[model samples]
Target: MDTKSLIIDTATKLFQQKGYIGVGLNEILKECNISKGSLYHHFPKGKEELLIACLQNLKQAITIDIEKIFEQYPTTQDAAIAMIEKIIKNLETEGTLTGYTFSSIVSEMALLSDAVRNACGELYQEIESIYFNKLTADGFSEESAYSIALMMTASIEGGIMLCLTQKTSEPLKTISKALPNLLNSNIHLVNA
Candidate 1:
């Protein structure tokens, strides 16, 4: 990777391994093996800027993955479950106690930086939108889809939080199994 990407990758790993408050600039510099001048050259606003960039990078990656899942699955329920299952599998593989990067960053920087807060908010909306669009495409009304999408987003995030705290993917697996039933129930109610 190039210098900027190298810096971003190192910072992202550190931030994910350690929360926003848990990591220090010196650690990032040492990990990246770059000088202060080089770091400042890529991220002038320093850690704050780097944090925002990392959030943006993660958000983009998530959006792409979610969009692909939605595109590949024929129904909202299938897509949602597949997405949740993928998360569970990933969490199982990584076995990290740190939880989701977005959650960690939001907990640490929500009140401190407007850019970070907005980026987080936008990321959430994008995630919710993925579900909203999928549900609507599956023939649910716009209002119903929007409401269900909100709940789905909340449930997935909550599952992630619980899984992280418990250090097990069982919570995610349970959530994943229930999502199909929940979406189907909502679809029936909306259509009925």
Candidate 2:
């Protein structure tokens, strides 16, 4: 990969392992084997700029993955369950959820930086939008789809936190099972 991409990738991994505040630019420079000048050349605003790039990169990558799942599955309920199952599988194999560490960043640095906060918010909205599109396509009203997408996003993020803290996949597994029921109940409510 190119130097800029290398820096972003290394920084993203480090940021995932450690929160935004926990990581320093020097560490990212060392990790990327690039000098301070090179980093600044690529990121004139330094760490915050690099972080925004990382969030944008993650948003694109995750958007593609979610879209693929939604395309492969016939229904939003099936897609939702598959998404949770994929997380469970990743946690089982890797011992942590990768590419989905915005929670840590939000908690660590969001209050301190408007740029970071906005980037994270945009990424979250993108995720929720993907789910909302699928739900609406599957026949949910816009209101119901929006609510379900919000619930799904919150639940998945909360499930990841619980899984990480508890050091087990039980929370996500439980979420996988609960999501279908949640969808079904919502459908019933909408029909009624």
Question: What is the Å distance of residue 23 in model 2 from its true position?
Answer: 0.8
Where model 2 places Cα greater than 4 Å from the true spot, the runs are: none
Local distance difference test, each candidate: 0.86, 0.90
Count of clashing pairs, candidate 2: 0
| Whole-structure CA lDDT of model 1 | 0.86
Reference-based TM-score, model 1:
0.95
**C-alpha TM-scores of all predictions:** 0.95, 0.97
**Strongest candidate by TM-score:** 2
Candidate 2 residue-wise lDDT, 1-192, digit = tens: 999999988988888888888899889988888999999999998899999999999989888898899999989999988888888889899998878657988898788999889999998999999999999988899999999999999999999999998999999889888898999998898788
lDDT of model 2 at position 107: 91
Question: Any runs in candidate 1 off by more than 4 Å, and if so which?
Answer: 97-100
